[model samples]
Target: MFDGVHLGHQSIISKLNAISKGKDLESAILTFWPHPRKVFSPSDDLKLLNTIEEKKYLLEKNDLQHLFLKEFDEDFRNLTGEEFVKQVLVNKLKVQHLIIGYDHTFGKNKSGDFSLLKKLGPECGFEVEQVEAVNYKDLNISSTQIRNALSSGEIISANEMLGYNYSITGKVVHGKKIGRTIGYPTANIEVDAIKLLPKKGAYIVDVFVNNTPYKGMLSIGTNPTVEGKLITTEVYILDFNDDIYGEEISVNFRDFLHEEIKFESLEKLIDQLDLDKKRTDEYLF
Candidate 1:
């Protein structure tokens, strides 16, 4: 799905670009949307690294010349390996060359692989190639692994695999006005429902408002110290005091700070907040 477009996906795209340039052919990617798993098993709590819109934005940064998003419906799912090759690759796209990952599979029940592609490529008047997996620190890089890292608040590891800092854009909304009382006003962000969030904790992040970046601290959790129930994503922009209740902002995670903890008293929570601010300032500076 190219969920995160991590190093592995980038490696394959690099190979595709190199070969396409050498052969004077167009480099393209054919990805399915709505995720086949989501269609097949609706009950699965499948958290993705990027939404479809985010995926498109990320892929555009690469050397890809073309991108085709096919809906993963029952009709597309029922196509056999050969049928897909003839209908989609040969007839519709007129694909001259196809590049895939080491373990890529397609068609009905994932019956198509490198071997199947090679077998049909000759008859279909096309070429097929597969790129080996990318590795980091002797471990294979994958979207699932990156998601796992993010789920556990391993920001550094996830960012290393992603080749960029993990970020999310959301609109500022109203909160209970509690932080301001402690001299640390926060912007409560309303994120997309489908966007996968990192583990519940405080993080040192770079906040972008109106495309301008600023250092900030983000908290993602149910505010137990405030006796709050709903999980909220809030950020306190350092040295920023603006009435931006409806403004859109982006938060780029830098590192995990600490887990959310319920303090004994509001005074204790303020002390911890001060410490968090000091640590965040030190790291950011």
Candidate 2:
């Protein structure tokens, strides 16, 4: 899967699992790394729903027997539709049956399709099956849709499509210590460069530290109130305080609180934060 591996992907994978079980075959996912988009446009600002590690973890949870991760580069991108099937699917994987998404395409110049796979399946000694798209709110569920929802600050809709809460995993970093002065200490998060972030705003989130969940208010934006231009993500965990710098954590976006605003003063910012905390408490509890 390219990104989120949302419900549509899960449907295909679930079909693969059922088919594999019925036919006494092993199931595996053949996914590419470095994303094809990143390969074609090296400098493009491409963000992904899940990092490689995150994708691996999710796939493992689905009880996949094997994960065939291929590094995508210039050479890999040049392979023809036939070469990919012959060299990779048939020879390497010995795949007896292939389950693909309805709109799935592969090979050089995106030439491969379900029809090509079906035509070649008999010759290659394999079966080809395609899973129909899953729809939510009359819209086809896709990584792009989820990404767009998140970019627009529609966390609830994004989570609904994902079949899980949208989250970001990162390491806690040091910040300018501004929140502390305002009586709300925060943990600055340093996330993966390629990881897709939700819209810049404040959110009601659940912070996962050492496998424990803590309610928190997350901020994602430039500190306009402080006249700072650098975009930062920080979380103020409620009812908890301890040094956690350098520790890895994950923040699950539960609800959108409000947009980032430039308060007139620090006092105004604190006052807004108090309201934010109250809203978060009401939502969480």
* TM-score winner: 2
Off by over 4 Å in 2: none
Score each candidate by Cα lDDT: 0.90, 0.92
Q: Which pairs of residues clash in candidate 1, taking residues 3 or more apart in a chain or in different chains?
A: none
Q: What tens-digit string does per-residue lDDT give for candidate 2 at 34-90?
A: 988888988989899999998988877887898889999898899988889999999
Q: What is the lDDT of residue 4 in candidate 2?
A: 86
Q: In model 1, where do residues sit more than 4 Å from their true spots? A: none
Error of 2 at 238 (Å): 0.3
lDDT for model 2: 0.92
TM-score of each: 0.97, 0.98
| Cα-based lDDT at residue 90, candidate 1 | 93
